[model samples]
Target: MIKMALMALRKLAEVILAAFTFGIVVAIISSAPAEPTDPAIWSFEDTFLFVFVYSPIFFLFIGIPASIFIEGIMKKINLRNCVYTHLVHFILYVSAGSLLGTMVALFFIAEGFEVYIVVWSTIAALCFYVALIGLNKIIQFSKEHDEE
Candidate 1:
């Protein structure tokens, strides 16, 4: 029961973090000075719309399915090894993050936004992966120390 609760809490944390990061990115983009006569550039309304449209699609279509698949694979392996489990989780997280980021960038490009989609999306993915990895390591280390 405790483990299940903890899992729920962790998932909640991940969602919150993703939303926060997305908000920060939107804020940064929105705060930039507008280029006169650049219709491709995003206005504040455009940024908000992008976020509003993309967030649910990302969570529902990409994030949830990827997470479920990864979890299923991990469970099937039944490996009682933290290192292997962490590695698999890290790789899966990176893959999902990258895929989602790329999709968002492509969507923006398709909508006629003049942003540097590849560079920004890659950076976003990397940052998210790094954050997740760091969080995982900290949790693992804490659990190990507690066991000791």
Candidate 2:
């Protein structure tokens, strides 16, 4: 049971780290100066706060619950460990990101919604996916090492 708890903690860490990375990459890449002499819209401090602080909060509210629901469904179907599951997750993340980003952008932006939303959302999805996968691999390696 302790081992299970440890693993859960690790997974939680993985999620938060991935979310932070995604936030940072998205914030940096999408940042732009509003005027020739003006500061970038997403300033360094804003990015830091958004990436390091708000990300975990958003992940708790949005990511964890969604992951739990999806994980339950995946476990039910016995596909949690299948090789194709990663691909499915990648596709799902991209699709959901695109849809949600587009909707939110549409509400706030009247022009150029297509470019920023679609591109950034896709990039964000990719960042999250890659970060999670890389972190999971590291966790798995450490677990194996501990067992040895």
Candidate 3:
């Protein structure tokens, strides 16, 4: 039982580290000044004048984690050892991101934050698809590499 506990803890650590990676990237991007000329980049990365205003939340909640998860799956490390670890990580991200977006949107709604829910939801979907494809590629590469 102790061994199982330790492995679970390790998986948790991986998730936390991945989340942190995404949080850092989001933070850096959020801190930068807005560039209004671009179409979609503006929404998440300084679409509004106050994008930086939400910088802390973006980094702490979203950026670091995502990157970590992406890196882990890409490297093909823990998937074999910790069954369901990947699924759990995927759930954690999608749930966490949605939760954050919903909470923030609520706060904004009070202050007249005029972003559409559909737009933010699309962002969530995009994140999911991107991760899915990337992981698939990693799996494909791993198979090819091992065949030799």
Per model, how many backbone clashes are there? 0, 0, 13
The root-mean-square deviation over C-alpha atoms between each candidate and the true structure, in angstroms, is: 6.3, 4.5, 10.0
Model 1, C-alpha of 46: deviation from truth (Å): 11
lDDT: which candidate is best?
2
Q: Give the per-residue lDDT of model 3 (tens digit) for 46-147.
A: 333343244334443454465456556646745554547656566655655666566667775776554565345334434443444464576679989999
Residue-level lDDT of model 2, residues 1-148, one tens digit each, is 9998975786588667767787778667656564436543666557656776755665555555555555565567665566778767777667756765777688868775666766765665566567667887887899899999
With a 3 Å backbone cut-off (N, CA, C), the pairs that clash in candidate 2 are: none
Against the true structure, what is each candidate's TM-score?
0.47, 0.65, 0.35
Query: Which one wins by lDDT: 1 or 2?
Result: 2
TM-score, structure 1 vs. true: 0.47
User: Number of the top candidate by TM-score?
Assistant: 2
Give the Cα error of residue 31 in candidate 1, in Å: 3.6
Clashes of 3: 13
Lowest-sum lDDT 10-residue window in model 2: 32-41
lDDT of each: 0.62, 0.67, 0.50
